[model samples]
Target chain A: MTNQKLYHAHIEACVEAMNACNLSYVANLKEYNLEKLCECIRITRECAEICSFTAQSLSQGSQFAGEIAELCAKVCEACIAECAKHNNQHSRECIEACRHCVEMCKDLMVAA
Target chain B: MTNQKLYHAHIEACVEAMNACNLSYVANLKEYNLEKLCECIRITRECAEICSFTAQSLSQGSQFAGEIAELCAKVCEACIAECAKHNNQHSRECIEACRHCVEMCKDLMVAA
Candidate 1:
């Protein structure tokens, strides 16, 4: 079984990213007519889903938790890149959350 | 932009998989102490998350919807394999949902 204590920070970051991405997704979805924000909405949804799954896997001590963390980090980076292109508060918060998640995933990978 | 009409069945299957996986996850979580069911619980959560994102992207006509569908199909397959090992109502439903999702994803991919 995996140890949750060791990856607590990583899990927290992933959860934070998930929440931020979900908020951003909903905000962007409302403005669906905006062509420029389509990619942002899509990537935010992707990031949220992956972060949610990664957080759940870590919390449950799944055998592939580390691999999921790696994938989550990659998606966070993509979310950050896309969200950065927009200047809204929601995008800013999402970028911050994704950045933190990436850092935490890096630490978790190193610790593993 | 991706056309939702072309992939309506795919989106429907993804939603079905998502709902079934969520149900299975909740059902198995109550029995989290059962080591044998842990994998099922974890995979169900994974499948649910990916299916959710894939459905949202397809509904929104995201440019990368096809790619997401591909990933969703792969996760559904994993869920099917893991859930198959367990013989329970939740697992059975998950397996059926994932199987349908995989078939729809395949059709969507070919059409794309």
Candidate 2:
């Protein structure tokens, strides 16, 4: 696939992962664990934002692609760690998605 | 402040930063740059999600806190790089917020 196509695909994957995290948070809301749920929401949102940005940066050949890649790795790691806490199916899926995105971001970073 | 408070505050900051990024993306929509705008939206959303998760993880002293911190750093860096391209007020603000969040995440990672 072309570089642009790859970047777009990566961003879409990240978005799916983040959406999974958000859904998990919402699902957990009824447990009155607002604190935990809220935190998850925040992290997932942040990851989604940066993932989107990284895809755009790559598509445009932005000068900051390398820097973005570095950040993407860190964020994905953080999200996975957070989701790992629940030991539930949703969290597990989130962890997997985050790991996938992290790897992609790292590859993009290297290429940049 | 207590560690819990600190974690909460950090999450809040990250949420704010991600929100800023999202708003920027929306603002740029009028330019018919769906590709760039969509990418930014996705990244901001992801960042927000992960930031929320990290805060919760730290609050609960999850084993994954360190991992989450690492991820946060990577995502923030990526967001900053992406936003740097616009040279507009919103993008610049997002970049600054992202940098601040990255620093916070790094500190959390070390502490974890």
**Best candidate, lDDT-wise?**
1
The CAPRI category of model 1 is incorrect
Q: How far off is residue A35 in model 1, in Å?
A: 0.8
Interface RMSD, every prediction, one decimal place: 17.9, 14.4
DockQ score of each predicted structure, in the order shown: 0.03, 0.03
Q: List runs of model 2 lying over 4 Å from the truth.
A: A1-112, B1-3
Per-residue accuracy of model 2 over A1-112 as CA lDDT, tens digit each: 2346556766766667667756664454344444444455557656656766666676765767678778878987888887777767877887888788888777777777
Clashes of 2: 46
Tens-digit lDDT track of model 2 for B82-107: 77767678888888877888888877
After TM-score superposition, the amount by which residue B10's alpha carbon in candidate 2 deviates from its true location, in angstroms, is 2.1
Per-model lDDT: 0.82, 0.68
Question: In TM-score terms, which candidate is top?
Answer: 1
For model 2, the DockQ equals 0.03
Give each model a TM-score: 0.52, 0.46
Off by over 4 Å in 1: B1-112
For every candidate, how close is chain A to the native chain A in TM-score?
A: 0.92, 0.76
lDDT for residue A50 in candidate 2, whole number 0-100: 72
